[model samples]
Target: MERAGFWSRLWALLLDGLMITIPLNLIWFMYQGEWTNNITQGWAWDIVYAAYMTILPVIWNGYVIGKRVLTIQIRKEGDQPVGLLQMFIREIIGKLFLGIATFGIASIISAFMIAFREDKRAIHDKLARTYVKNRI
Candidate 1:
């Protein structure tokens, strides 16, 4: 079967984010009544989201609940199961650039490149040595 492309993977991520946002926001509200009232609480929620994004992919064989629902899984370039270290690097370090303006620009370029690149790898995927593929 053909590999999944960058857009497909991005669509899956958007769906995943939508799935998690409600519960995460609710948890944040329980910790602090409003998002602006407590910086520490906001940071705490960020940590939780980070941990969820990072650890779930590793433990679930690269399919977080969203990806699983989308029938996609992350794997190494040669189709090996993704390891924890790779997941950490991918979900943490690779995605960290997303918060910075310059890095965001870089991300756009990287994403466009990934769309047409032969290996079908986004910047995070290249850095982490991973790919998202349709589950067999």
Candidate 2:
């Protein structure tokens, strides 16, 4: 039940972000013939990102694509699998709200918390009473 390290978690998140971005960019390119128009579709992308974070982990047993690839999983406080409600709280309330309110500044802070905190719990993880751990 060892907590996942900050670097590992950061790389996983980047992978997930890329997973979302690459497809969207390709679709935009095919439809609009350009990939540089991301700003105009930021809101739509955010919604997709929110859905990605919330639904995937619950359906995938606490592992998003990135987490699965990285051999890490999100778990409840007692090392149990995350419930749907927990995923909602973590991804919607904690991540989505903070991401929008601060224009993604809060996510940066969450990374710092994970990096420096003894428990390696980011704000979202603390809010959801969840932690990322190396999958057994």
Query: How many residue pairs of model 2 clash at the backbone?
Result: 0
Give lDDT tens digits, candidate 2, residues 1-136: 5899899988998999888888888887898887764633667877888888898888888999899999999999998889889999999989989777999998999989998988999889989999999875
Instruction: Quantify all predictions' global Cα lDDT against the true fold.
Output: 0.75, 0.88
Q: Where does the lowest 10-residue lDDT sum fall in candidate 2?
A: 34-43
Per-prediction TM-score to the true structure, in the order listed? 0.79, 0.87
lDDT of 1 by residue, 55-110 (tens): 88878888887778778888977888888888877877777645354648767876
What does candidate 2 score in Cα RMSD to the true structure?
Answer: 2.1
Candidate 2 residue-wise lDDT at 3: 91
Q: What overall lDDT, based on C-alpha atoms, would model 1 receive against the true structure? A: 0.75
RMSD of each: 3.2, 2.1
Where is the poorest 10-residue window by lDDT in model 1?
Answer: 34-43
